[model samples]
Target: MNVKNIFAAVAILAATGSAFAQQTEFVAPDAAFQSRLTRAEVRQDLAQATAEGTTAQRQHDGQDTVYAAGGRSRQDVRAEAIRAASIRHYGDVNDTYFGG
Candidate 1:
């Protein structure tokens, strides 16, 4: 082989060797997969649960108001119907979330 061809081969070999050197291995933390969640994470979960509950309550109230409204054609009666339902809804508000 010519000297130029030999030099090209050596360069290719050197580049290939660098690829192996650049590789890295990962290791788990000292506690591994048994790590406990942080306090902030727990707080986040609780907050999320609370928000979800509130959203569900709102959705329920919306559905009840819609039902009470009867139909969209009677828009004039809708507000009155919802207002009347609020009286009973006050009593229904008794739940764990409200400290009941």
Candidate 2:
């Protein structure tokens, strides 16, 4: 063939070889398929966490949870809400569009 065709074929072959070379092998994790704690140890840890009431909340378990009370009192919250409501809400199209 001509020199141009030979050069084009070499270029295509070089590109294909470079593309295949630019790959990374899969690396397994350091602790692949292995656990530091046995099943019985895991069970014991779960039991201890349950006894201390530190376990994560599950979905729809039908249990009532009471959160700790905040520092603000009910009257304080009501007063803050009233003060906030009294402040004019800017850009409210429904009320006093001309700032009247």
Candidate 3:
């Protein structure tokens, strides 16, 4: 209404806009995990695993699956990627959670 109130409102709006923009630009650790995955491959693995059971169960069931090899499974890779990104972005994972 008045000049002082208008300026205060504009300042508050500017601060809020900047904070929202910063948050949108910020990438979460889970986003980094998803970004590293090949969507097609991950989807296929997930579908197959879901159709059967767990990936490990499918492997034990004598199904020659791509994920049965001696490497990290899709979930493991995703988890590790998230953990790495969290450590990179936040300095430490446990510290971020525990406030240490």
Tell me the spans in candidate 1 whose CA falls farther than 4 Å from its real position.
Answer: 20-100
Candidate 3 structure lDDT: 0.75
- Tens digits of lDDT, candidate 1, 1-100: 6999999999999999988885377665674566479989988987998988853444343334333434555666888788886654446566677554
Instruction: Please write out the lDDT profile of model 3 over residues 1-100, one tens digit for every residue.
Output: 6999999999999999887664447666676453557889889989998888876543366565475355668899999889986874454457757655
For candidate 2, lDDT tens digit of each residue in 16-89?
98887744777667736778899999999999999999999788866668767899999999999999978876
Best by TM-score: 2
What clash pairs does model 3 have?
none
Q: After best superposition, candidate 2 residue 30: deviation in angstroms?
A: 42
lDDT of each: 0.71, 0.85, 0.75
**Model 1, residue 53: C-alpha shift (Å):** 4.6
Candidate 2 residue runs with Cα over 4 Å from true position: 1-57, 60-64, 92-100
Inter-residue clash pairs, candidate 2: none
Task: Estimate candidate 1's alpha-carbon lDDT, on a 0 to 1 scale.
Answer: 0.71
**How does candidate 2 score on lDDT?**
0.85
Clashing pairs in 1: none
Candidate 3: regions farther than 4 A off: 22-100
